[model samples]
Target chain A: MHEMGIAQQLVQIAIDSIPRDIENPKVEKLNLRIGRLASVVEHSLTFCFEIITKDTPLENARLDIDVVPVTVHCKSCDNGWEVTGPVFKCPFCEDGDVEMLTGREIEITSLELADELKI
Target chain B: MEINIQKKVLEANDTEADINRTFFKDQNVFVLNMMSSPGSGKTQILCKTLAKLMPHVRVGVIVGDICTTNDADRLKVTGAKVTQINTDQFGGDCHLAANLIIESAKQLGCEDLDLLIVENIGNLVCPAEFDIGEDARAVVLSVTEGEDKPLKYPLMFRVADVAILNKIDLLPYLDFDAKLVVDNMKQVHPHLPVFEFSAKTEEGLEPWLDWLKIKVFEKTGK
Candidate 1:
């Protein structure tokens, strides 16, 4: 339900973060780090990104996404594991008191540009 | 050749949520963000819950909708401060961000209240990804919906602190299996407590309130 709006945000944020001191900045790629636990579909985001970036500075920008997998730490046992599915329980200790380590990030890591560009 | 921005896509929203978290802590208010799909009986459950929760704890609610204050109007009669936020004016988004919640809560004077509940815009996907500076998150699933919803939307189930299996009253008339849903919910997040109850019948509502009371006390330390 939100790929379109989030893509719009991605486009705006990407364009705003570009260096303005250069003459005719041209963006080539937008790198994104998304968590597996995050509710974002890579295909949907790519589709939305292409549509919103049309005619904008990011029109030719390729979306490079890195899917971060879910990892958790068991507080009771001090055990950590890379979770493959939806289960968050501590497999070693059966403790439910677990904290997520890496699976909730939703951020723009960097931008590859041919030259300096304006959004 | 490249610029390292390392910025969050929802930086504005995250900053606002951080500000809201600080304000909620300063105000000593325990906040809960409740989410569900449309027609999950979220309002009906809230009405029943407020009726029982208001007498003991000072509660406030912010109801969000696409165009109307219908949910807020229903919640106001419980004597708890209630406010309605229509997302239509704010780009008509499918989710309620913290920037909107803090404004509505402050208008309700939530600083004086012991508990603040935000009935998030009825959505499973977008709302799950957005944090509204809440101490706890709850997801409501009715018997009318698919049992595999937890598997389909693992992010929502994974993020929720608790799950509510609503509409047990309709189980006899439908093919939905409550146990399977509970199992599916646990498969996604084993730690979350699931409450099975029918808001219409007022059955199984007490346990949820008890859980809420404990959460409020744990956070407010009162």
Candidate 2:
């Protein structure tokens, strides 16, 4: 599945961003903001992430996923509406030609590392 | 310390893709990244395309698939230089990345080629996100997949410069509305050129071939 590839990329990104001073920074959590239309299955991504990070520094990292819904702006009625389902039409004007404002993102928003001072 | 790194995760891959863009530019090669779902007749289109253009243009193909070289075998019948990249060994990658394309280019013998078509693994979503340093990305949609595919996979339709509605030969049997697909694609990408054709019967393939000719001439001036 493509989720495995994405998971591997996420893990690599986190590992690459670690500070050199920290010997082995234990990843506490990974914050991801994935949009609803990104075609990424959240459950599949989480499952793959766990398997990929088993022996790595992010062994016990928690995945914090925020699923963003598709928001569309209708040019006909000048109204914006959140698309809840697979259909991407404006609720106000019933326009199929509405512009998609969001819901195509797939990014690692932030990373939470264990505080070395507390350790 | 929580580091808020807003950097793109695929920056490394993008850098490599830039190298590929420069390489293609230097070679005066027009590369096209072809993407579609499984059994959408991508190889069939390539075969028909090569049959028409091989007499005048130098064409090469780098086929990406999960396992077999079945597509490559089909392309070989067209007498075009074809190379297959089995991505199954690398965990069944859904798309071919720029690094993989670069590696395939080496084995493809790029010096003797003018046009290189990369038939990406039969997946719509993931392949559209990855830029493989191609001049244009063409999305193939067969009539059997239903008319709502453009709306369902809008990102792929939006990213593509050209949309080929293939398998028109089967349109009479199916209740698929071709106009719906065209409308949906136009909604996502207002000016994307859509070519309706069947690679099997060679129906409505002339315009697509002509478009390819114009594209090659525009890029290489030959």
Candidate 2 Cα deviation (angstroms), residue A91: 11
Query: Any residue pairs clashing in model 2, and if so which?
Result: none
lDDT of residue A71 for candidate 1: 89
Q: What is the C-alpha lDDT profile of model 2 across B1-222, one tens digit per residue?
A: 687866555667678889899988888889999999999999999999999999698999999999999999999999989999998788788889899998888788888787999999999889987888999999999999978888788879877889999999998899999999888877666667999999999999999988888888899886
Residue-pair clashes per prediction, in order, are 2, 0
Model 1 chain A: lowest-lDDT 10 consecutive positions: A110-119
User: How high is the TM-score of chain B in model 2?
Assistant: 0.98
* Model 1 collision count: 2
- lDDT (10s digit) by residue, model 1, range B83-170: 9999898778899988998888788897679999899988888998888889999999999999999988888998899999999999
> Which predicted model would earn the best TM-score?
1
Q: What share of the true interface contacts does candidate 1 keep?
A: 0.83
Q: Candidate 2, which segments miss by more than 4 Å at Cα?
A: A66-103, A117-119
lDDT of 2 at B64: 96
